[model samples]
Target: MRYFALATDYDGTLAADGRVTKDTLTALKQLRASGRKLILVTGRELDDLLQVFEQIDLFDYVVAENGALLYCPASRQEKLLGEPAPTEFIKALRDRQVNPLSVGRVIVATWHPQETAVLETIRDLGLELQVIFNKGAVMVLPSGINKAAGLAAALDEMKLSPHNVVGVGDAENDHAFLSVCECSVAVANALPMLKERVDFVTDSSRGDGVIELIDKLIASDLSELDEQLQRHNILLGTKKDNSEVNIQPSGSSILLAGTSGGGKSTLATAVLERIAEQKYQFCIIDPEGDYENFEGAVVLGDAERSPRLTEVLDLLEKPYENVVVNLLGIAVEDRPAFFAELLPALLELRSRTGRPHWIVVDEAHHLMPASWNPASLTLPQQLEGMMLITVHPDRVAAAGLSLINTIVTVGNSPQENIKAFCEALGDCPPQIAPQTLETGEALAWFRGKQTEPFCFRIAPGHRERRRHARKYAEGELGEDKSFYFQGSQGKLNLRAQNLILFIQIAEGVDDETWLYHLQRGDYSRWFRQAIKDESLAEEAEEIEQNNRTSAHESRDAIKGAIAQHYTLPA
Candidate 1:
């Protein structure tokens, strides 16, 4: 389901004359029966609200006193979310003759024309408090406490994300929580400013408007909201012209394409970091173990073992937990079959609960090869919250490519990569000027938006990128391809087979042997040809060419480079 909860206001939204109609109550029950949660956010005190309405139990949770308290109707448990109203502040208000004053667990409220006195009292008392106005009423709360904070606490207890909630209100104070919701709604009778700031306005007023929204939610799960998601779109980055680049989180697919050694993984890391920071659950399909270092995501499996599908699914069921499924132990050829089985389960889970909001497939070409058939795997008609990363987009299965609505290309030849992806889809590539992107930059093309491709500097990732070490440290190498060390006395004819052995030999050998290799450019040559890493080789070359360095210093520098690039096996 797209929306899992409906958070509505009480006074001017669901209640008229301080009472809920039988028809509105019936609608609320029907909404709960549809497996959706109900949250009542109101500025009224719990005692006052209970006295006015007898059907308060219809709501699972109530945030009262304008975010000062959280109440669970079933358990009849009330928790104060903020500090109590200060005695001095309350006394000062009374001294100022603030008539008809009311006090709750953490809120002090009164009608309009008294806000000036309330502000003066708060200032005189030097209290960290804020005043909120709702129509003719004025409420004072702790500085950081508001309807949004209260709703957050309620949702946290319910294990739900604001991204899965739709909030409705009809007044000024309601803006705080409504703005935080995935979809903001307002009743037709709401204030002009309130209605203008929301995504949708109901055709009816008060309880009838709420009933109208509930009916629509139960019928379609708010599927019509897909078009209005632009208001909730996330900023990817800024373009060259300083325009903001954005993407909708629902019913969209993004493909990151580039050659090896480019910033493809870096760009993916930035995007994932934002997704994680936003509290959206994501599952990363890591083919080369690239994303295990990401913060807040649990890494499953390793080089020695394959991840169990059951464990992955279990972890993702929790709304806040994320998982990285490492495919190191699984055979490369069998990845598609494994993913074929996993996709159906994931889709089923998403259908039942809008969880595991995103699925990022790194090295996507391996799992969805060009020869693979679309019908071979279970895929939703609309691919929402899916991201595919690949070095070669043309190598991915046609079915997978067909679902992609956005393309982000990195590297020196971004235009060529974009062209290749377009050709793979059998569509003419749009004309884009060739531009050189820096280390953390890319060209973004939103096919669905049909806008011209623009350049955007990708944001840096939160977690430090994990560099692969096993490939250089323990990988087997042929004798002829190994690094040979010659001593001063004679040619030892000794070969270091791997990075670990090379480091050991370099450390033990005499200064002459090290200098000989350095002067001959042998270290740089070996790094380039054997490891196929130009950047590492360049650093080694820089150390060799430094005339100010001694033979021992050079050897130490070379060893440091090897150790930094490769991890020693335990």
Candidate 2:
């Protein structure tokens, strides 16, 4: 789910006059019953919070002492996340007669007028501490500690991502954690600046406001918050005018269209990398087994076994995890039927939890061909968080194309592809000329936007894109396509026939044979021309030029580079 956990401030948010209302308590129970977690993030001391609120056990975890202490209600365990206030510091404060001093495990606090004394004490002692203000209260904490850090710790322990959390607060200290959450909410009586900064402000004040938010979450899973997802928009690229091009994560479908070897997968890989970085959950339906090795995603199934629908759904139930459903073992003709069965369950899950935020279908034409009956599949009228990658747009179902609001074409005839996509839907194509684009560049057109199509360079992916390992190992290499190695006596036509055979030969060859290939840049040339992987080829070239070591070491380096790019058969 986009937001499966709610982190909330205690005072001025879930409580009024140091007490939670019965209504709010019931709402909390209902929210927990819905399988959502509740975390209390407050500046209050753990002991103080316990004295005021008897229902402390209702929350799963509590961050107390303004982010210095973490409390688990079920275990009744208090873990200090920050160092305690120094005894000398406390003595100095007391010696200066700083009245109304309150000290906790890791925090020292006082009212507003005493902040001057606190600051003086800090400076005089040369202490590495900071004071945070919340209305009349001033809290002293260790440097680098805040509600955000505490929430992060709690999420880490719980196996949750900050992007799946919705935070609500009403005070100055609330800003840090709220900013990190996927959606920030503020109560009606929140500080003016805090309210202005949040994505949504509740109509009711105090505990009532929290209850209102909980009700909304349960009713629609906060579907009304689709617009708020814009805050975490992914940058597509920059426009010709130097403006940034971006796309929101909700209620939007993206089509990455181009012919084979035109960088369509590369562009999609870049986008998926950004998605993973943002911690949004995505399920990749990999028809060609291309994305199995992408970072931060769990690869399900392989060539010998097709992923079961039940298993896929179970893995996706966790909001923090990404899944790549490899369709290598599934028959080509059976895919559409499988997807038809899977899509309805996915839609139902999203309806309940707003999870699996994106469903990426690589090679869209194969699964939803134009010849298939759209009515046979249970597709949504308004596709949200869908990305379709394809070489032939016209081959995909017209119904599928109708839901795409953004088209990113990455080939020489981008405008022509856009026109074909439009014609497939029986709509007039936007007037735009096709521009020649280099690799990792595209022409993006947002369906309803007034601006014309613009050329943009795709952002490089953080993780290496997965190459087609089986293809490199088993696929044919024509005589003209083979890479040859030269020797002392004569030219050895050791054809770079397949990755598996090439690796075996390289490993068994003598040092002289290995050095001969390395010195001649044969490995780099073969990687570029035979393997069709420019990035790996570039790395191989760098290794060849930089290695001043033994031939065996150079062979190991080259083999490592190839293994990184292609998976060798056992």
Candidate 3:
């Protein structure tokens, strides 16, 4: 169920001449029976809409008064989404002879040709309200109030996301709400502008068009239009010829394969950042706590504790929260079993909510080994969007590899990785020139492209993502990447393998020794190259160059800089 709800405009959309057809009603019922929700978004006032339409209860929610009011059909509850129409404003409109005027709890509406008078009265009164036009109807409501606002309020109350909604509309006023839905439809009778802008315009007009839409949703979830919604496709990178490479957020499976220190996490970070920016939820099955400090997501477990399955699921149910399931506390061999149990629950949740939109399985080989079979359910069919990253694709389960539709290889062995993946799938691999990918570059093969894989510059992330923050902060770094202090005469030979050790050693080293390294720009260089923290390095560079500051002052300043970004030991 990609689209979990249908939000339809009332006038000239779901209803023709303010009446819904029996066939449309039957279609709506059948859609609801499919376990999807329905919402009515209309510019008509609640009282008028209720009196004119007998099938009010057909919708779970009614976003009326053009987004100024929210009503729950089941509870018979009405909530004002915006402040009520001001008494003075209404009185002024009456005085101005804005004829055929009507007022709702929060809307003041009149037929146009009086819109000039409405605008003049608003200016004369110096009111902070906006006028919206729906064909011949002129409506006045608070600024930012519209069908979209109302629908958002209704969706919030329903615990649903706009990405899970499919909206249909007919006229100018429908643009706001329709634009926000994952899929927008316009009836055949819809205005030319609306029809041009919508994802699809129905062949049939009015309520019949709605039935056509509902039938399509129930039958296929509108899968035929998957490629048509290019607005939702995430940009992966640009190709060799400078053409874009995009991954559709829905029904996509990507394999990001590379060796350690190959910048796979860096590439993955950029993708996740894009997902978060779009407000889609993702669950990262972090086998190594690499994402514990990831931005815009709640880190479920840490180095010392593994979060319970129920806790992770409970947080994910919100449809807005992202979760990082850190497996640091879970033993290495037991990770596959934990993920085996977790995958089904996650798939079940997505089946119902269409969320945790992307599931990222890091270190795929270790977590879902080739020996671990998921035969009970077909992963390639059940899973929608996922990114599986591993050093060895052959080590990952064949079932898991089957889910991949696009293969993005990072690091030195790009061709080998793709060839190995193709062998694992028992398919012929595409040919490519034998070469090494430069730093921050990747070779991507999108299935069915009819061409060999091409190299592209990997897009960078905004944040200096401390990918594997725990490793840089606490774990041992190889001697090559570690910072060593044997300053001046080499009286004291101390190696700071990680950040915590660096800070402790800095505090104990003599002032002259500290000054020696600080003067040499060693701190900034080590931070940028070893820790992979560019911002922290810039800050350290600033502090290191200031000769007026004492060694102790620089130490505190540097320590504070690290603490500002990375969490330091208390």
Candidate 4:
């Protein structure tokens, strides 16, 4: 997990003699610059601490009076965590010749021997307050008020979890906050007791020590790793990192089971899109000619010409998307033979490219027969990511169905198919029948016994392609025939141009930089630049808009044009 916040004791830890050194101050400022939350846990009174650390606003928040009071450095506001000392108790301490000093909120300190009367009076009042010894100072506050408690209170106000924090300290009072953090660090000059109990002991002392810790953290690559893990949570893994997704080891393929018109293709597209986002190449068997429009994808077969297996394999070797093997017009008997030849080449390509993120076969029953042995098509385990989309999951090979790492069922009648899938795999969780899976809803079956299947909506951002599928089917856009010609006359040429520009922006080229090439009439270079662009943001937005507008216009025009030209013998 990313360390979102840092909790450090002020006196003796971050600052010696209540004054932070210039180096320590700079290090803290650097941590702030890096977007880390800085919290100071201290035993000093709020105002006194502020006096010592005059640039108080450097800290995001502060825990003062050990753990009894909290303060916001930016607002200069203080919050007392406990009630003030009773007037009677104060009077009693004074009567006993004890010199009671008001420190910070709810905290009163006094010397030990003369403070006996105050202690007795506090106990007599049946209060939970207690006096804690820090060096020579006897500090009194509500019982359980300590540096750790103070830090916890401050953290609550900030909505930060201890698990996302790393505490650094050198003193006894800092122990509470240190022990609770995910990573506890101590400086070299720190007390041996504190250092021994902490998770990491830095070689440097004081300010240099904290900087050393930050340097180590940034070098560990925790930030990037956390980002990927978060995606895993939303996709294949559990919602929280600690909760792992149980992928059934035996499942060789995940069957996207659903009825026709139930967003099966869209859901399948989402899976492949995610795989592609991870830079995994994919080959989608698009029998219905769907998936060809996906960006970065290659269409293998069309009414014009079907690419040879060698051609498809070559394309697969170079990371491309929507690598479609259109088998729609092929005779039914010929599909198996074609797939038989195609599968081995795909398996070889998987071996060559170290496996694309996924191998997606849509209209599975039509292409990959249940009787066909998956073993024959199996790539080495190192390069295997398989996905099958079918209306009838039962019709797909039971053996093939057993290999699913994740099963996304879209329609209502999938209980039986899921049940059969479980039976084939042995001890599969009982299928939870979706009451109503409207368009983007799906039940994702995770791979472990302890985990439960989740019914989640594919986030709207991830569902654009799926929405387009509905538009494609509805004739809201032109019919499928129109898509072929929409780009034919180059009316969609701007889209191609914009798409190339979008890619250039993604590839770290600024608009001004790419515009230079476009102004120079470098069309070929422009497209090349766009194809290798790595920015997902600009590409997705442009592609989304491009498809919506051009695809819509092209669909309408192509349908009208076809009708106008092809009138029959009346």
Give the per-residue lDDT of model 3 (tens digit) for 1-570.
799999999989988888888999999999999999999999999999989898889899999999999999889999998898789989998888779999999999999799999999889989899999999999999999999999999988988889999999999999999999999999999999999999999999999999999999999999999999998888877867888878899988899999788779888999999999988899999988889888899998877998799999999989789999999989888888899889888888888888879999999999888888663353635467889999999988888888788899999979999999999889999887788988888988986667678888877776633445767888899999999999999887799999999999999999999999999999999999998889999999999989898998999999999888877668
**Whole-model Cα lDDT per candidate?**
0.86, 0.85, 0.90, 0.62
After superposing candidate 4, which stretches have Cα over 4 Å from the reference?
Answer: 111-118, 221-570
Top-scoring candidate (lDDT): 3
TM-score versus the correct structure, for each prediction: 0.70, 0.67, 0.81, 0.41
TM-score of 1: 0.70
**Inter-residue clash pairs, candidate 2:** 1-355
Candidate 2 global TM-score: 0.67
Please, what are the lDDT tens digits per residue for candidate 4 over residues 1-570?
246678888766787766778877877777777767889887788878766788788888888887888889788788888888777777766666677566456888876564566668787877678877665667888877788788878766765556457889887667777877756889998888888787778888876788787776656623423332232222433333334333221123566777887767665665565555654456777777776577768777775666588777666554333377777666667776777678777775443333444677788777765666653354343223677888876666655665665677767655565675676556545646536666666666655435566665653335564343333333232222221112223342222223322232323433343333333334333323432222432332343344334433433332333234223223
How well is each residue in 1-570 modelled by candidate 2, as lDDT tens digits?
Answer: 456899999988999998888999999999999889999999999988999999989888999988889999999998899999899999999999998999999999999799999999999999999999999999999999999989987886776767778899999999999999988999999999999999999999999999999999889878798767677999877766778778887657998899888888777888888888887889999988998788799998889999899999888877678999998989988988787777788888776667788999888899888887853356767877999899999888988888899999987788888998999999999998647888778988889878777788776565433344566765667777666555655556566677777777787767787787788888888889877789889998988897676887777887788778776766
Best by TM-score: 3
Q: Residue 60 of model 2: what lDDT?
A: 88
What is the lDDT, from 0 to 100, of the residue 394 in candidate 2? 89
TM-score of predicted structure 4 = 0.41
